[model samples]
Target: MQRRGLLLILSSPSGAGKSTLARRLMGWDPTIRFSVSATTRAPRPGEEDGREYYFRSRAQFEAMIADQQMLEHAEVFGNLYGSPRGPVEAAMAEGRDTLFDIDWQGGQQIRNSALGRDVVSVFVLPPSIAELDRRLRGRAQDSEEVIAGRMAKSRDEISHWAEYDYVLVNDDIDRSFKQLQTILEAERMRRDRQPALTDFVRGLNREFEQR
Candidate 1:
């Protein structure tokens, strides 16, 4: 049956494993496309345009916003970042889901956009604050100050958990991933997502009348 694609929005605190889960979901379904965001920040070494981000000048980024070309946008740490609307809509038209790994603010904007009806948002949470801190420290990728800042921000992020369609406490990666897969599968079967089902049911009704 022909099915319309959905936008899967995953949001969580810094160490809550949303990024990890997003990667797993993509691996499980290779056809899913990741939403590449546009950013005004200069690319670091080894980062390529369109792969890591769609690098744009601040003026160009603002122009996109002015023209209503961005699905969602935000200023973070003095840099502008947003998801371009064109590519996501195109993917949806082609029956390809787009995955978004963004924070709560971005998720909120996209969920409230014109494409809101097609959005399925999930929020990931840590089992405990101590576990969250442990996971961040275990990565050893940040300085003490940076880790502290993330921990502080995590509270605010967790506060928004009730806003999501589904919430997963990511205490176990494999278990959480299974739950995510279930959510996607169930959502795919929703009557609204599969428009072709209407015609199929109509045909059945006609056959019944003929019988």
Candidate 2:
């Protein structure tokens, strides 16, 4: 018997440090593959094709949607982005876990799909609204207008916290990361995922009877 892979979905508001935890998680476990999405937007400087995204023309993307090739898709800022169904399915069959750093909408789509049972969703929240604002400002990459827009959107994002299986308030990075790791460890040990356990237990029973 073998084990099936899991789909780990992580969602958070703009400044809640979801990406940081995701990076640390991957660093902790190199076998987990990050789900690369396809976008209709052009690649930015130093961004390679098929690495950051599978950049496609709008027509190409629309065709994929019509052909039912996308696992999940949504329009953002007038641009289309979607996760490809092929690579993700391939990874799953190979027993390699996939990590999705997506919003609640994408997470919901994945969780409601044919492979829904394999999904383990987590939502990361900021310690407080003031701390979230401070984290956004501390980045120094956004203007006041952009920050305000993000803060507005954060309210909507935070409202979906109850949708996830696990919710972590990221008051400290180390503590949050440890909790995330623990979740992964426990999820991996679930009886359904470890199909080999059946055979292992059968062998144990046979050996004990012979003794």
Candidate 3:
């Protein structure tokens, strides 16, 4: 049966392993498209335009928002970031799933947008605050002040856990990834997603009547 595409949204506080999980998911299913967001922030070293991000200027980013080209957008750490609606909708129309690795605010916006019916939102939580702190520090990419800021913001992010359709505590990467796979498989089987099922069931009923 041909199935309609879905939007799989993964949201989590920084250092909770959502980004790691997102990469793993794409590796597991190369057909899954990652929604490349447009960001106003300057590209980091080795980051390329339209690869890591769209890398737009603040004015360009705001213009996209004003023109309603963004599927969802939010300001974070003094920069604007958003998913472009065109590519995502086009992928979905061609029966390809799109994965979004965004924060809770962006997740909420997408989940409430016109395409909400096709969205499956998941929130990842850390096992403990201390562990979350440790993970941030372990990254060694941020300063003490930056890590401290993320730790504080994490509490607010965690508060929106209940807003997600699924919540996973990412204590073990392997186990969490397995659970994510299970969720994706099950959601793909949902009745509404499989439009071909209608014709299949009708044929079954006709065969039963003839028999």
Question: Who wins the lDDT comparison?
Answer: 1
Task: Please report how far candidate 2 places residue 38 from its true position, in Å.
Answer: 0.7
Q: After superposing candidate 2 on the true structure, give the runs of residues whose Cα lies further than 4 Å from its correct spot.
A: 201-211
Instruction: Give the number of the best model, judged by TM-score.
Output: 1
Candidate 1 stretches greater than 4 Å from native: none
In order, the Cα lDDT scores of the candidates are 0.95, 0.93, 0.93
lDDT of 3 by residue, 1-211 (tens): 6789999999999989999999999999998999999999999999999999999999988999998899999887799989999998888888889999988889989988999999998999999999998888898878889887888899889999999999999999999999999999999999999999999999999999999
Q: Write the per-residue lDDT of candidate 1 for residues 50-160, one digit (tens) a residue.
A: 999999999999999999999999999999999999999999998889999998999999999999999999999999999999988998888889988988899989999
Provide TM-scores for the models: 0.96, 0.93, 0.93
Candidate 2 TM-score to native: 0.93
Which clashing pairs does model 2 show? none
| Sort by lDDT, top down from the best | 1, 3, 2
RMSD of every candidate to native, in Å, equals: 1.1, 1.9, 1.6
lDDT of 2 by residue, 1-211 (tens): 5578999999999899999999999999998999999999989999988989999999999999998888889999999999888888888888889999999889889889887999999999999999999999999988889998999899999999999999999999999999999999899889999988989999999999999
Worst 10 residues of 3 by lDDT: 143-152
Clashes of each: 0, 0, 0
